[model samples]
Structures are given as structure tokens and as C-alpha cells.
Target: MAYVAAAAVLLGLLVVTNLILTVGVVRRLREHTAELAALRGGGSGGLDVDVAMPAGTPVGGFDATSVADLPVSLATLGERPLVGFFSPNCQPCKEKLPSFVEYAATRPQGRDAVLAVTIGTREETAALAELLGPVATVVVESDQGPVQRAFGVSGFPAFVLVEEGVVSASGFDLAPVVDRDAVALPAAG
Candidate 1:
């Protein structure tokens, strides 16, 4: 009888320990999720504390030649253009490339309405440029290139939806840009 009681006590302790560890893990995961969301520009933080340029910021003037040898500039961007900044060495940029391309493909104006700026050497950026070519106007530039500088982009995989040279939506994730046109109005009461 004593042995049975001791065994029961040990099992209870083990179960309690497991529950505590699980709670700790869940708490830690929540914290990490919040941090990642902030980094991804999903929070209320502005560009000063956020990952990239914020919505409503005006795009500064910039001029650069596309991979096709065509001139690309703020003035050349059609109304409601989508702009994406990527870096060849950034893992997140690579991971986000496919999604960006998919979203760009859905644009009504097609390739002419999207600009993809890749920051790296021509050799390093080749693959990215090719991937983005079919969907956007691919521009290869250095880290301090005019395109990135004009956008005030301090992070890779940054996306912005420009409406007449002004940012209507911008974020580290494409959600803001992709969902901008999805706003719905309420029905009359």
C-alpha cells in the first residue's frame, strides 16, 4: 500500500512538471510571435521603429535602369504600382519571392505595374532577377542603390503599394499591399 501511494505521488509530480514546462513553452512562443510580427511590420510601430517604410510616406525620386535596359523611375511607375525590395543574400527575401511573384501576377496592369528591385551583384542577383522578370520590372542594384534609397528601405523583402508616387500601403509582409484593394464596405443599416 505504501509503495502504491509513493508511486502515485511520483506520477503526480511528473504530470505537474510536464504542465509547467508546457505553459512556459507556450508563453515563450507567444513572445516570439509578437517580436516576429513587429519585425514583419504587422504592428502599430512606425518606420522609425519598424522594419521598413510606413504607409502614407511619399516616395522620393529615383532613377535606375531595369534588367531589360529600360529606365525605371518614380515618375515612370504607373498609378497604383506595386514595388518590392529584395536582397540576394536575404533568406526571408528568397522565401517571400514566390509569394511576391504570385501577387504581382494578379495585378491588372501586369508586369508594367510592378517593380522588383534586387540588391546584389549582377551575378548574385541573376537568379532572383530571372524569377521576378515575368511578373515585374526587374532592377538590379547595389545595397545603396537609388531605388532602395528612394524608398527608404532599411530591410529586405519590403513591399510597398504606391498610388501616384505616394505609398498607400507598405510592409515587410505582402499582406498589406495585397489586401489594400480588398477593403469592403458595410451594408446600410
Candidate 2:
């Protein structure tokens, strides 16, 4: 009888813990949605994740303004939307590339639109091109100066989806496109 009582108590505790966790998750998601909505309504400046370094913090041996100067033009990259800013050395970038590639292949917007930009030397860029294969449009920004700052990218594998010269989305969540039915996932067999 004691053993059965203990099991019942444990089960009750487990249920309570799960409920707390679920409530916390839902609250967090609501905050994020509200924040995203506010950012969207603000217009043009783009969403800035707090993780990005402050303006003066040194990165890649360059200041923010220097990083911002890497020249980019919509014309040079073609008419498709740009998915710029990543580094060859970043582990998360490496892991995420496969998903980006797969996403690009399956969705027309992704296929025609996404471009992966890497800050590396010519040889390094070539190696990355090999790594990514023909799955993405890979470009090298040998000098990270202006280019990095302009896009406000302080980390590896930052993605900005640009359409018609406007920044549509930025950061890790591709959920907007995925959820909006803009990009279709692979059909279940």
C-alpha cells in the first residue's frame, strides 16, 4: 500500500511539472509573437536579435563600419532573393547549410532565391563551394569590412531574405515562410 501511494504522489508531481513547463513555453511564444509583430510594424530597419554584438565590439578583426562595407548589389547576385552572411568556419553554419540546401531544392522560392555568402579568401570560398556543392549560390566576401556592417551580421550563418530590395526576414526563425504556406515542405509519402 505504501509503494502504491508513493507512485501516485510521483505521478501527480510529474503532471504538475509538465503543466508548469507547458505554461512557460506558451507564455514565451506569445511574447515572441508580440515582439515580432511590433518589429514588423516598425518598418525597414529590420529585426535585431540581442545576440548581435554592440556597435563598437571588435569582430573578425574589424569594427562594425568596416564589417558593413562588403559590397553587395541585387543585380550581381541575380533577381532572386538573397540569403547572405555566413562563415566557412562556423559549426552551426555547417550543420544548418544542409537544411538550407534541402529547403532550397524543394521550394521554388528557396531554389530561385537563396544565396549563401561566406567571408573567406578565394581558396577558402572554393572549398566552401565544394562543401555546399551546387545546392546553393555561394559567394565570397574576401574583405568583411562594409558588407558585414551593412547587413548587421555579427555572427555566422545569418540569413536575410530580401525581396524587391526590402528585407523580409532575418535571424534563425524561418518559421514565417514555413508557416505561412509560402514554402511548402516535402509531401508525406
List residue ranges in candidate 1 displaced over 4 A: 1-48, 183-189
lDDT of 2 at 97: 68
Candidate 2, 17-119: lDDT as tens digits: 9999999999999988887664433222355553223323322222221122433345434333546465777666666667666665664554335556678
- Cα lDDT for residue 117, model 2? 67
Model 2 spans with C-alpha error above 4 angstroms? 1-72, 76-80, 109-112, 143-146, 173-189
Taking the tens digit of each residue's C-alpha lDDT, what string does model 1 give over 24-109?
A: 99999998777766665445443345345677788898989999999998777777778999998887787788999998887777
Worst lDDT run of 10 residues, candidate 1, spans 180-189
User: Considering every candidate listed, which one attains the maximal lDDT?
Assistant: 1
Q: How many residue pairs of model 2 clash at the backbone?
A: 13
Error of 2 at 22 (Å): 35
lDDT for 169 (candidate 2):
55
Candidate 1, residue 180: lDDT: 79
lDDT of each: 0.82, 0.54
Q: Which 10 consecutive residues of model 2 have the lowest summed lDDT?
A: 59-68
